[model samples]
Target: MTEISTLIVDGILAVLLVSVIVVCTIVYRRLGTIKSGQAELRALVDQLNTAVVDAQRSVANLKTSATEIEGRLQIEGKKASAIADELGLITEAGNNLADRIERGLSGATAAKKQQAPAETSASKKQQEEILAALREAR
Candidate 1:
């Protein structure tokens, strides 16, 4: 009976040892897979960091370019204002010249009505000159 008990105990111990070996093998394989996943995660984080840095540089350059364009637009705005002022002065002078020409023609017609036969060769030359001036102005 004692030998039979010892045999049963030994068989149980062998079975326990085999179970422990199998559990250890499974744990080792899982640990290997976790290590490979960790390495891939680290590589992905490095690439994301690099892309963030590049984006920051691009934003900085774009800001500088926008500032330069704004400065150019301001300069152009000043030049346009100056040109508008010059054009206003030119328009005013043209208006004054047109008024003078209109008044001169009206005065000449009134003088002709006031004195007809008294107008001499000199007066004829003057009328001719005025007509010539009017035509030239046109």
Candidate 2:
């Protein structure tokens, strides 16, 4: 009876050790899964940080481009204003020329009217002289 009791106690101890080993293996596997999940989370965070930096750089470049374009537009606007001023001066010159031509034509027309009666008397005397010469020739 004493030998039988000792054997049964040893068998129970063996079973308990086996059960504890299995529980420890399960816990270790769970810890490894948690570590793998943490690594994946860290990689995702790194990718997000890179994306944010790239977005900021793009915004800065766009702002610079916009500023340059605005400056160019302002320069073009000044050039257009200068061209318009030159055109206005040319238009004024043309108008002044037209006024001078109109004045000259008016003066010529008045002079011709004053000379018409004198020209007609001179023409009549020349015709009488021509008629006398023709009679002599005959």
Candidate 3:
């Protein structure tokens, strides 16, 4: 009876050891899975950081380009304004010259109606003077 009891005790201990080894194996596999997942998470975080940095850099470059474009636009706008002003002055001068020419023609026509036909030399001289004035205005 004593020997049979000892054998039974040894058998129970062997079973318990086997169960403990199985539980340890399961825990180790789960730990390994968690470690792999953590490595993947770290890699994803690194990629995200790189993307953010690149985006920031791109935004800075865009801002610089916008500033340069804005400066160029302002310069072009000023040049356009100056050209418009010059054109306005030219137009105003042309209108004045046209008025002068119209008045001179009307005066010559009235003078021709008032003068005798023998005063043709005087009319020709007046026309020459008007032509010289027109040339000088140019």
Using lDDT, give the best candidate's number.
3
The true-versus-predicted C-alpha distance at residue 31 of model 1, in Å, is: 2.4
- Prediction-by-prediction clash tally: 0, 0, 0
TM-score to true structure, per model: 0.63, 0.49, 0.61
**What residue runs in model 1 are displaced by over 4 Å at the alpha carbon?**
1-17, 109-138
Candidate 2 ranges with C-alpha deviation above 4 Å: 1-41, 113-138
Candidate 3 lDDT over 1-138, as tens digits, reads: 889999999999999999999999999999999999999999999999999999999999999999999999999999999999999999889868867886878687768768755666776778768766766766
**Top-scoring candidate (TM-score):** 1
Give one digit per residue, the lDDT tens place, for model 2 in 110-132. 57558664556564565456545
Ranking by lDDT: 3, 1, 2
lDDT of each: 0.86, 0.80, 0.88
lDDT of 2 at 94: 68
Ranking by TM-score: 1, 3, 2
Better of 1 and 3 by TM-score: 1
Positional deviation of residue 56's Cα in model 1 after best superposition, in angstroms: 1.4
